[model samples]
Target: MSRRSSKIEFVGSQGVPLVARLDLPEGTPWAYAVFAPCFTCGKDWLAAARICRGLAERGIAVLSVDFTGIGESGGDFADSTFSSDVDDLVRAADHLRENFAAPSLLIGHSLGGAAVLAAAHRIPETAAVATIGAPAEPEHVVHTFGGRREEIERNGEAEVSLGGRVLHIRREFLDDISAQPQAERIRRLRHALLVLHSPSDETVGVENAQRILDAAGHPKSFVAIDGADHLLTDRADARYVATLLAAWAGRYARGSVPAGPA
Candidate 1:
């Protein structure tokens, strides 16, 4: 079936307009999903776009969003925190619920993954959650900041290069990531989980996936992407992820109940 893609704009946690792309399958969708891209990676990233396209081809409509301060979204990157990212996820869900259908599946990449885990409990309609190259703790993202940590601490903010793009890193951002109780959130996550990570991923080690899997309860599963990098830059890798995700999500993405109250 041919898929259709459309641009969308919605208010984010900071009251700033967030830009997103909605990929819809031919005819009515069986389910709706939200995709949170990797840190500093926009909704238009190659991997994110391909994954959404893949899911849409399989009958699921997907909303791929650019969080505040990234891509086409309006906001200051330095001013945004992990907490706000989670809030943005909730806002995205609310937008879907109001205009289409509540998202039954939540998928995130890298730091975005951690955000979904923390936000899942708030979205009562979410029945399945998936993470790719996600860190077990939000603070784990600091490693990418390198020496800029000291500069941000001393100056309150510092411009750091990430994925070849310069971004303002702030002490508040560090504090927020550190303060997030991700382990606790994972333990209490009521949705079915699918954790995908590459053993060769240099950015986020495979150990992080193990920790997340350990913290999560039943109905959770993990897949090793093997030779794929953290970003799943290869088209094949991204498509494989989408295919497996659609299959796994089939069991839980519609009306699946939580094991218990979140």
Candidate 2:
């Protein structure tokens, strides 16, 4: 299979120019998908790049976005919130709908999983949603702030370091996450849902998988990303996730074989 990727930019919900990597197969794709990366991670993060490109090679075009203030996108981290993230996801889906085909599948990693669950309602064309090592609620991300959680709470905003990058975290972000009704969103999510979590994932924890599954309605499924890390840093593990996702999403696509390995 001939697969390629190109950088694309679009206006985000906040009107900032957000960057994305659109991975495409050689010819017209039967289906398309949008990917939301882990919090603070860029589009080229190992897991994001591999999984999107892997999907492209399998005949499914994938648009992997670097949300506001992250990666090549333009915005201030301290000013971004959970609600903005969800809006950005909807904007990404809008881009796909206007330029190519509406994405039939939506996938997320880490806190982004929560974003997709909440944004699905805004994108009516989305037929399926999948998340990798996602938290059941947006508020769960507060734990990652560690001692800085107090600093942000007391001062309203604080600069924090993540993955070797220093960024600002504002109190509004905390408050916004707390206000999100993620569980209710999952319960009402009309699309088929797939939850992929690593039983050994030290970051998000496996219990979250159960929490999401229990809240979601029919056509929900859970798959253990056995022996995988939170980021799916291992090539083998990411490949497995991509393979499974392409196959699962194929059932929703109008026409096309399940995208298997090239």
Global lDDT scores for all candidate models: 0.91, 0.88
Position 152, candidate 1: lDDT: 92
What are the per-model numbers of colliding residue pairs?
0, 0
Off by over 4 Å in 2: 255-262
Please, what are the lDDT tens digits per residue for candidate 2 over residues 59-104? 8899999988898999887778989988988999898889887888
Error of 2 at 125 (Å): 0.4
What lDDT would candidate 2 get against the real structure? 0.88
Q: For model 2, state the Cα shift of residue 214 in Å.
A: 0.3
Which numbered prediction scores highest in TM-score against the true structure? 1
lDDT of 1 by residue, 85-180 (tens): 899999999999999889999999999899899999999999999999999998999989899999998999999999999999888998888899
Native-to-model Cα distance after best TM-score fit, residue 252 in candidate 1, in Å: 0.4
